[model samples]
Target: MVTIRLARFGTKKRPYYHVVVTDSENPRDGRFLEQVGTYDPAKPIESARIDLSRVDHWVGVGAQTSTRVRHVLNDYRRATQAIA
Candidate 1:
């Protein structure tokens, strides 16, 4: 089944990840359907940069985001909306 998840990349001690849409059976760093965004944990401050518009687009097209990805989206939405 197809799903959206993070794909590990980079070399040696430093690591990077790509937010990709791929098959569940594929390796974490293997082939994917599309690259939607990226995540960098090596920065002075940890951060995740996601294409929210693309994410919404994919979800609208019936692409299922992983639990982690959903959390990111949910957090962003909540923060932007400033719900009490």
Candidate 2:
């Protein structure tokens, strides 16, 4: 099954995440099909960036999103809309 989730990267104490699409059986930071967004906890919430068009396309193709990814997507959407 294909799934949408975060892939951890960055320094030991400084964490960064790439929202990616991959197989359900794959390891957390293993190979991913595509990167759709990014999350940097140290940055301001509004600074987080996401590619909603790609995300929507993936969802339409039956990709399932993790709970945390869903929350991040929601916040990103709201933030982008507010600035537009």
Candidate 3:
């Protein structure tokens, strides 16, 4: 099973996350199939940058998204549709 979740990165004091797709059995920071976005927790506004098309592709291929990722996707979809 493939899971879409966050992969931790960056220095000890400052952290960032890569929203990634990986096997459910893999470690949190282990082997991952694709990097779809980034999350910066420390940003004043709590920002995330994502590739909506890639996320949609993964969803189409049966990747089960984490709860947080689901929220992000919802926002992304709303924003894209509003623009379109």
Candidate 2 whole-model C-alpha lDDT, 0 to 1: 0.92
- Please identify model 2 stretches exceeding 4 Å from their true place: none
Off by over 4 Å in 1: 44-47, 75-84
* lDDT of predicted model 1: 0.76
Better of 1 and 2 by TM-score: 2
Model 1 quality (TM-score): 0.69
lDDT of candidate 2 over 1-84, digit per residue (tens): 999999999999999999999999999999999999899989976888788999999999999999999998988888888989
> Which residues of candidate 3, in runs, are more than 4 Å off?
44-47, 75-84
Task: Give the range where candidate 1 is weakest over 10 consecutive residues by summed lDDT.
Answer: 40-49
State each model's CA lDDT, in order.
0.76, 0.92, 0.84
lDDT comparison, 1 vs 3, better candidate? 3
Rank ordering of all candidates by TM-score, starting from the highest: 2, 3, 1
Global CA lDDT of candidate 3, please?
0.84
Model 3 poorest ten-residue lDDT run: 39-48
